[model samples]
Target: MVHTHAGFAVAGRPTRTRRSAVALAVALLAVAALLVLSGCSSKPDVVPSADAASVDVAATVTVKDMTFTPATVTVKPGQAVTWIFDDGVVEHDVVAADGSFVSELMTQGSYTHVFTEAGTVNYSCSPHPRMVGVVVVE
Candidate 1:
Protein backbone atom coordinates (compact mmCIF):
# COMPACT_ATOMS: atom_id res chain seq x y z
CA MET A 1 0.00 0.00 0.00
CA VAL A 2 1.13 3.72 -0.80
CA HIS A 3 0.57 6.76 1.47
CA THR A 4 0.89 10.66 1.10
CA HIS A 5 1.40 13.61 3.52
CA ALA A 6 -1.79 15.31 4.77
CA GLY A 7 -1.76 19.09 3.86
CA PHE A 8 -3.78 21.78 1.91
CA ALA A 9 -4.18 20.68 -1.76
CA VAL A 10 -6.55 20.73 -4.72
CA ALA A 11 -7.28 18.28 -7.47
CA GLY A 12 -5.19 20.07 -10.22
CA ARG A 13 -2.88 22.52 -8.25
CA PRO A 14 -0.08 22.34 -5.68
CA THR A 15 -0.87 22.85 -2.00
CA ARG A 16 -0.09 26.14 -0.14
CA THR A 17 2.70 26.02 2.47
CA ARG A 18 5.09 28.35 4.41
CA ARG A 19 5.47 30.54 1.27
CA SER A 20 1.95 31.99 1.75
CA ALA A 21 2.79 33.09 5.29
CA VAL A 22 5.88 35.00 4.04
CA ALA A 23 3.78 36.84 1.34
CA LEU A 24 1.20 37.98 3.89
CA ALA A 25 3.92 39.31 6.23
CA VAL A 26 5.48 41.34 3.39
CA ALA A 27 2.12 42.90 2.46
CA LEU A 28 1.40 43.95 6.06
CA LEU A 29 4.84 45.57 6.43
CA ALA A 30 4.32 47.58 3.21
CA VAL A 31 0.99 48.98 4.43
CA ALA A 32 2.48 50.01 7.79
CA ALA A 33 5.36 51.82 6.10
CA LEU A 34 2.91 53.83 3.92
CA LEU A 35 0.96 54.97 6.99
CA VAL A 36 4.11 56.12 8.82
CA LEU A 37 5.37 58.07 5.81
CA SER A 38 2.06 59.93 5.40
CA GLY A 39 1.96 60.96 9.06
CA CYS A 40 5.47 62.46 8.94
CA SER A 41 4.60 64.80 6.01
CA SER A 42 1.75 66.60 7.79
CA LYS A 43 2.25 70.18 9.17
CA PRO A 44 0.92 71.97 12.27
CA ASP A 45 -2.04 74.37 12.07
CA VAL A 46 -0.53 77.41 13.83
CA VAL A 47 2.95 78.83 13.58
CA PRO A 48 4.96 80.22 16.49
CA SER A 49 6.30 83.78 16.61
CA ALA A 50 8.70 85.31 19.14
CA ASP A 51 9.02 88.93 18.03
CA ALA A 52 5.99 90.63 16.50
CA ALA A 53 5.90 94.14 15.05
CA SER A 54 4.08 96.96 16.85
CA VAL A 55 0.64 98.06 15.68
CA ASP A 56 -0.20 101.60 14.48
CA VAL A 57 -3.53 103.06 15.68
CA ALA A 58 -5.06 106.05 13.90
CA ALA A 59 -8.41 107.93 13.65
CA THR A 60 -9.99 110.60 11.41
CA VAL A 61 -12.45 113.52 11.89
CA THR A 62 -14.06 115.70 9.23
CA VAL A 63 -14.52 119.50 9.23
CA LYS A 64 -17.29 119.90 6.65
CA ASP A 65 -20.10 120.98 9.01
CA MET A 66 -17.78 121.72 11.99
CA THR A 67 -18.21 118.40 13.86
CA PHE A 68 -16.18 115.39 14.75
CA THR A 69 -17.50 112.13 13.28
CA PRO A 70 -16.74 110.10 16.41
CA ALA A 71 -16.99 112.51 19.34
CA THR A 72 -15.28 110.08 21.67
CA VAL A 73 -12.60 107.42 21.18
CA THR A 74 -11.13 104.78 23.50
CA VAL A 75 -7.65 103.36 23.00
CA LYS A 76 -4.71 101.81 24.78
CA PRO A 77 -1.77 103.85 26.07
CA GLY A 78 1.05 104.57 23.59
CA GLN A 79 -1.35 104.28 20.67
CA ALA A 80 -1.43 107.00 18.01
CA VAL A 81 -4.62 108.85 17.03
CA THR A 82 -4.76 110.70 13.72
CA TRP A 83 -7.30 113.42 12.89
CA ILE A 84 -7.79 114.12 9.22
CA PHE A 85 -9.25 117.32 7.82
CA ASP A 86 -11.43 116.36 4.86
CA ASP A 87 -13.00 119.75 4.09
CA GLY A 88 -11.04 122.10 1.88
CA VAL A 89 -12.75 125.33 2.85
CA VAL A 90 -12.11 125.32 6.63
CA GLU A 91 -8.94 124.98 8.74
CA HIS A 92 -8.79 123.09 12.02
CA ASP A 93 -6.53 122.46 15.00
CA VAL A 94 -6.42 119.76 17.69
CA VAL A 95 -5.60 121.12 21.13
CA ALA A 96 -6.09 119.44 24.49
CA ALA A 97 -7.88 121.39 27.22
CA ASP A 98 -5.27 120.61 29.91
CA GLY A 99 -2.32 121.09 27.50
CA SER A 100 -1.72 117.35 27.48
CA PHE A 101 -1.65 117.09 23.70
CA VAL A 102 -1.67 119.42 20.74
CA SER A 103 -1.47 119.38 16.93
CA GLU A 104 -0.54 122.01 14.39
CA LEU A 105 -3.11 123.66 12.17
CA MET A 106 -4.30 121.12 9.58
CA THR A 107 -5.51 122.55 6.29
CA GLN A 108 -6.93 119.61 4.29
CA GLY A 109 -4.29 117.36 5.82
CA SER A 110 -3.83 114.84 8.62
CA TYR A 111 -2.59 115.33 12.19
CA THR A 112 -1.43 112.53 14.50
CA HIS A 113 -1.13 112.50 18.31
CA VAL A 114 0.20 109.71 20.54
CA PHE A 115 -1.45 109.13 23.91
CA THR A 116 1.02 108.00 26.53
CA GLU A 117 -1.05 108.51 29.71
CA ALA A 118 -4.11 106.57 30.81
CA GLY A 119 -6.82 109.22 31.14
CA THR A 120 -9.57 110.99 29.31
CA VAL A 121 -8.37 113.97 27.25
CA ASN A 122 -10.85 116.54 25.97
CA TYR A 123 -9.75 118.21 22.74
CA SER A 124 -11.27 120.69 20.35
CA CYS A 125 -10.43 122.69 17.26
CA SER A 126 -8.88 126.06 18.09
CA PRO A 127 -10.49 127.80 15.13
CA HIS A 128 -13.91 126.26 15.78
CA PRO A 129 -14.54 125.82 19.50
CA ARG A 130 -17.89 124.13 18.80
CA MET A 131 -16.08 121.11 17.31
CA VAL A 132 -15.28 118.92 20.32
CA GLY A 133 -13.76 115.42 20.68
CA VAL A 134 -12.51 113.23 23.48
CA VAL A 135 -9.75 110.60 23.66
CA VAL A 136 -9.98 107.98 26.40
CA VAL A 137 -6.67 106.24 27.01
CA GLU A 138 -6.59 103.05 29.01
Candidate 2:
Protein backbone atom coordinates (compact mmCIF):
# COMPACT_ATOMS: atom_id res chain seq x y z
CA MET A 1 0.00 0.00 0.00
CA VAL A 2 1.23 3.54 -0.64
CA HIS A 3 1.08 6.17 2.07
CA THR A 4 1.38 9.99 2.06
CA HIS A 5 3.37 12.13 4.51
CA ALA A 6 0.24 12.52 6.65
CA GLY A 7 -0.19 8.72 6.84
CA PHE A 8 -3.11 8.64 4.40
CA ALA A 9 -3.42 5.83 1.80
CA VAL A 10 -3.29 6.56 -2.01
CA ALA A 11 -4.61 4.41 -4.96
CA GLY A 12 -2.87 5.88 -8.11
CA ARG A 13 -5.96 7.90 -9.15
CA PRO A 14 -3.82 10.62 -10.87
CA THR A 15 -2.22 8.11 -13.27
CA ARG A 16 -5.61 6.77 -14.41
CA THR A 17 -6.88 10.35 -15.02
CA ARG A 18 -3.83 11.24 -17.15
CA ARG A 19 -4.31 8.11 -19.28
CA SER A 20 -8.00 8.97 -19.92
CA ALA A 21 -7.10 12.50 -21.01
CA VAL A 22 -4.50 11.21 -23.48
CA ALA A 23 -7.00 8.75 -24.99
CA LEU A 24 -9.60 11.49 -25.42
CA ALA A 25 -7.11 13.79 -27.25
CA VAL A 26 -6.12 10.99 -29.69
CA ALA A 27 -9.78 10.19 -30.47
CA LEU A 28 -10.55 13.88 -31.19
CA LEU A 29 -7.58 14.19 -33.58
CA ALA A 30 -8.67 11.08 -35.54
CA VAL A 31 -12.21 12.43 -35.97
CA ALA A 32 -10.93 15.81 -37.24
CA ALA A 33 -8.69 14.14 -39.86
CA LEU A 34 -11.54 11.98 -41.14
CA LEU A 35 -13.84 15.01 -41.49
CA VAL A 36 -11.24 16.92 -43.55
CA LEU A 37 -10.66 13.98 -45.90
CA SER A 38 -14.39 13.48 -46.48
CA GLY A 39 -14.85 17.18 -47.34
CA CYS A 40 -12.09 17.15 -50.02
CA SER A 41 -13.54 14.11 -51.82
CA SER A 42 -17.02 15.63 -52.30
CA LYS A 43 -15.97 18.52 -54.61
CA PRO A 44 -15.72 18.28 -58.43
CA ASP A 45 -12.76 19.47 -60.51
CA VAL A 46 -12.83 23.10 -61.68
CA VAL A 47 -12.07 24.02 -65.33
CA PRO A 48 -12.07 27.32 -67.21
CA SER A 49 -14.82 27.54 -69.84
CA ALA A 50 -14.36 29.53 -73.08
CA ASP A 51 -16.93 32.14 -74.10
CA ALA A 52 -18.91 31.32 -77.27
CA ALA A 53 -19.03 34.92 -78.44
CA SER A 54 -15.34 35.58 -78.02
CA VAL A 55 -13.37 35.99 -81.28
CA ASP A 56 -9.72 36.35 -82.21
CA VAL A 57 -8.68 38.29 -85.34
CA ALA A 58 -5.43 39.75 -86.58
CA ALA A 59 -3.97 42.05 -89.32
CA THR A 60 -0.48 42.94 -90.45
CA VAL A 61 1.09 46.11 -91.85
CA THR A 62 4.63 46.45 -93.23
CA VAL A 63 6.90 49.51 -93.12
CA LYS A 64 8.82 49.69 -96.39
CA ASP A 65 10.04 52.53 -98.70
CA MET A 66 9.31 55.01 -95.90
CA THR A 67 5.61 54.11 -96.02
CA PHE A 68 3.16 51.77 -94.37
CA THR A 69 2.26 48.90 -96.65
CA PRO A 70 -1.50 48.40 -97.15
CA ALA A 71 -2.00 51.74 -95.43
CA THR A 72 -5.56 50.76 -94.51
CA VAL A 73 -6.68 47.73 -92.53
CA THR A 74 -10.14 46.62 -91.36
CA VAL A 75 -11.22 44.09 -88.79
CA LYS A 76 -14.00 43.23 -86.38
CA PRO A 77 -14.05 44.43 -82.79
CA GLY A 78 -12.02 42.43 -80.29
CA GLN A 79 -9.44 41.61 -82.90
CA ALA A 80 -5.69 41.93 -82.68
CA VAL A 81 -3.44 43.40 -85.38
CA THR A 82 0.31 43.26 -85.78
CA TRP A 83 2.62 45.69 -87.65
CA ILE A 84 5.84 44.31 -89.03
CA PHE A 85 8.59 46.72 -90.01
CA ASP A 86 10.77 45.72 -92.90
CA ASP A 87 14.50 46.42 -92.79
CA GLY A 88 14.79 49.99 -93.95
CA VAL A 89 17.53 52.65 -94.00
CA VAL A 90 15.55 55.11 -91.83
CA GLU A 91 13.82 54.49 -88.48
CA HIS A 92 10.03 54.72 -88.27
CA ASP A 93 7.29 54.89 -85.61
CA VAL A 94 3.57 54.19 -85.44
CA VAL A 95 1.60 56.83 -83.52
CA ALA A 96 -2.16 57.05 -83.30
CA ALA A 97 -3.92 60.28 -84.28
CA ASP A 98 -6.20 60.24 -81.23
CA GLY A 99 -3.39 58.92 -79.04
CA SER A 100 -4.77 55.41 -79.24
CA PHE A 101 -1.59 53.44 -79.91
CA VAL A 102 2.13 54.18 -80.20
CA SER A 103 5.14 52.18 -81.30
CA GLU A 104 8.82 52.73 -80.82
CA LEU A 105 11.15 53.48 -83.72
CA MET A 106 12.27 50.14 -85.09
CA THR A 107 14.26 49.32 -88.19
CA GLN A 108 13.18 45.68 -88.23
CA GLY A 109 10.67 44.55 -85.63
CA SER A 110 6.97 43.94 -85.03
CA TYR A 111 4.32 45.70 -82.92
CA THR A 112 0.88 44.34 -82.06
CA HIS A 113 -2.32 46.18 -81.19
CA VAL A 114 -5.69 44.89 -80.07
CA PHE A 115 -8.79 46.70 -81.31
CA THR A 116 -11.49 46.65 -78.68
CA GLU A 117 -13.84 49.37 -79.98
CA ALA A 118 -15.62 49.82 -83.31
CA GLY A 119 -14.24 52.93 -84.99
CA THR A 120 -11.66 54.31 -87.38
CA VAL A 121 -8.18 55.08 -86.10
CA ASN A 122 -5.41 56.89 -87.97
CA TYR A 123 -1.74 56.50 -87.11
CA SER A 124 1.52 57.93 -88.42
CA CYS A 125 5.23 58.05 -87.75
CA SER A 126 6.82 60.95 -85.90
CA PRO A 127 9.87 61.34 -88.11
CA HIS A 128 8.08 60.39 -91.33
CA PRO A 129 4.57 61.91 -91.35
CA ARG A 130 4.02 60.47 -94.81
CA MET A 131 4.19 57.00 -93.30
CA VAL A 132 0.56 56.70 -92.24
CA GLY A 133 -1.86 53.84 -91.62
CA VAL A 134 -5.51 53.41 -90.72
CA VAL A 135 -7.38 50.79 -88.78
CA VAL A 136 -11.12 50.26 -89.08
CA VAL A 137 -12.81 48.04 -86.53
CA GLU A 138 -16.43 47.00 -86.72
After best superposition, candidate 1 residue 123: deviation in angstroms?
Answer: 0.4
In model 2, which regions exceed 4 Å deviation?
1-57
Query: Which lDDT tens digits does candidate 1 get at residues 56-118?
Result: 565445555678778888888877676767767777777778776566665776666667889
**What TM-score, over all chains together, does every model reach?**
0.56, 0.58
Across residues 25-52, which tens digit of lDDT does each residue of candidate 2 receive?
A: 9999999999977755321221222222
Query: Candidate 1 — worst ten consecutive residues by lDDT sum?
Result: 43-52
What lDDT does the true structure give each of the candidates?
Answer: 0.67, 0.73
**Candidate 2: what lDDT?**
0.73
| Residue 133, model 2: Cα distance from true site in angstroms | 1.2
Q: Which residue pairs overlap in candidate 2's backbone?
A: none
- Give RMSD to native, each candidate: 23.1, 19.9
Clash list (residue pairs), candidate 1: none
Candidate with top lDDT is: 2
